[model samples]
Target: MMKSFFKVIFLLALTTSTKAQELRFGLQPIQYVSETQGPYVDFFSTLDASTIAFEMDADSIWHARFKVALSFEGKVDVVRFEYTSEDSASSAPLMLQKSTFTFDDTKEIEKRPLEIFLYDEVSNSDWSFSDTLEYVASDFWLSQPVLLDDVEEVPVNYVKRGVSVVPVASLGLPVFENESTLSMYTEGFVASGKYILQYKLTDAYGNIIPGTSGFARCNTGSTPVYNKIDFSSQKSGQYEYSIVMLDSTGQAVAERISPFYWYNDKADEAAWNGPEVSVTRAVFENGWGQWSQVNEYLRMIAPVATMSERRIMTNLKDSEDTARIASFIVNFWTDKNAMDPLGEWKGYLVVVDKVDQEFGSRTVPGYRSQMGRVFLQYGAPSLVEERSFDGRNYPYQVWQYDQLKSSSTPVQQNQVFIFVDQELIGRQYTLIHSSALGEVKDHKWQYHLTRHTNAGPDIDATSTQYSRDNFGERISNSIIIGNQGTWFDRF
Candidate 1:
């Protein structure tokens, strides 16, 4: 009798192991209702598998959980459970389930229906299986199954992401979606007087989910701020307005088109044409001398400027002063020449004439611009070529000075100036390049020059002299001058 009992127990264990199977599925928890309404509930009741059993800790309370089980080929698995009342009322449902199973290939069982049974319990209500359900199954080995639960509260948190502004000119007068902001700046509504509108949306846990849909609504008189959409003077047409999604940090994630209102049935059109010219003139005159000259220029030309213009101008100096100094130096050189160094000041005048011819405009004269003045002083280069070797669309100019009669290699310097109404007022200058010529003998400078502007080359370099091919391009057959002993040796 004892031996028989032991054998029966061993066989029962083996049979149980052989009959078990596993199923794999995914679960995504969702919020079905508001926290104040009650705990959200979702049911997964129509499963057809045999030998059903759930994989879960019988004791611990699961914030989110999924159900999984193993069953025999012709049997069904039943998983029945309920959330704790205290936690269910406020918390989200379980997300997935976990379980393990193994099968043996030594024997095969006939295919059969695998059924899953589910039920629920409520106050004063008898526990009963739901009948309005559907089932789907497949032939093959089962893995793990997942069951999802509904979430209660949708928590949200938002932050100010970034701020940007587009110039009114670039957007045109009929701005459609010109001003925008993320949830960080759109949360508040206006109650009276003046207020700010700021809002944000977050998940149940207060984490921001970018690109989610949500809306904010409140009466203007009840909030501290309001969106006084000033379409008062906008054209007579339909407009749109909408609340766009932001990133996890409460920044606007993408551009969106929203809804807007219309102002039809013409009322005095000229009334909304904005302030009169005389009013603007009066304001400008009153604020004119309050700022530094440079600051005033910046305010006048800059796309946007409210204050601080005077402060900036006071700290800046005029650039024409340097240009004047350069002009004086040229005059000094001309006066010192025993004979005409290059010809009468005619050569210099020719350079000035070229500058005027090429760069002179209604607003800016050729000599006033840097490139214009440089051309006037330097004369037409010996060779001029344009190339677009770089991966840029703009063509760069190359200026070659065959033998730039200078005592030393050229030292490059640059200056920038701000002008107002054709008058130079602010200047910034800096030295950018200087070729080193140490105590090494037979030092001579050779240069190939380029520039960033339209008037000059984009790249410049210098190396040993070489021969020219039939096309006059430098060939690789010439000797290096720096390696030679003296000027005579170089020749």
Candidate 2:
């Protein structure tokens, strides 16, 4: 019996020694507890991995309540216990109780412990658990705000809003050369607001040339008001210029740059010859068509006179030689094989008469009107597509050219003008299609569309496809002109 008992004891000791051991690590100040009553107990539970618990000395005489408030850098669970002393004054004895605590996701605890003095119910106090707990907490990740101070950079070639320069000198007897005023007029340069203008002139080598004469910059209130910069002294030479505008902020807001050349052939008579002129004088002195005779006379002198002499003599209306001069201009560009000797001259004469009847507003004749100018330049378009828009729909006009030499782009070098009969005063025509003049090369056929009411604030314009190789043959070509609506409807 004694041996069996000893064997049992040895087996029990071996079993105890073979059991698994547990190791624990913990965050300090494991838990804090506060209570309104004496002898309160608090319990803190961390992840099952590792933990350490702490409490005040159990032998202390102070009857402080253990109101427990638990918090953690990570996640944790908690419980509380209350112990009351048994007293003989009452028949029921004080008992110990327990409660579980759960917390929502938050950096701080939603509920805190309250201390109530036993003698006074109205006197309650509260304190943060972090302040009471003397242990250091782990660092947590947080978000912070950032600041930016650099200015945004944009391309120097950035085009400004509502600023564009278009072609203007498409037709007419070169008003640019005849007008006495030294002015620089750009067709499409327009601005609705106040702007300051600055300009620079440069030579062909792209270098600024000083003391070249004929340079002046005139300021108009805004663009499309026809601001003129005099280059009278700059003389007939090629030079590029840039017009820069500034906003109220002193920043460069817009720029208009282009190159132009002025050739003065007065010093070189050999180069001063103008277009060919053929004259046919009437053998009988009959003034039935005296103007015809004058035109022919001018044509005969066109190829022989110097540039200066032509400029002076062409404007001489009261000279004794006026009749002879008129005859020369009359026969200019005549078809020798025509059944009527004056057929070609008669056609052009009709054009001049039409301009006078339709567009003559000021002292200048109808040819000066935007419409008349185009009529003479292109020699009556093969087709005329015209429409009027009240406001809500599209309105346009198409002029078709079957044998344009440049490219297959329609309306490649054409111009469109918009005018309001209501505002039928000076400079009523707003020039469009100014950019089409020199930029396109493959245009053989062209179409022009104006897509808005003649009096509206906004107008949209575009061109059509063109062909070069085919002429007189029916080509699969269509041109659109309008103010608004779909492309097909524009036709």
Per-candidate TM equals: 0.18, 0.26
Candidate 1 versus truth, CA RMSD in Å, comes to 32.1
RMSD, one per candidate, in order: 32.1, 38.9
For model 1, where is the 10-residue window of minimal lDDT? Answer: 2-11
Model 2's TM-score against the true structure? 0.26
RMSD of 2: 38.9
lDDT tens readout by residue for model 1, 100-165: 111222223322222232222221212221111112221111111111111243222101112211
Model 1 segments more than 4 A misplaced: 1-334, 338-347, 368-370, 388-392, 406-491
Q: By summed lDDT, which 10 consecutive residues of candidate 2 come out lowest? A: 4-13
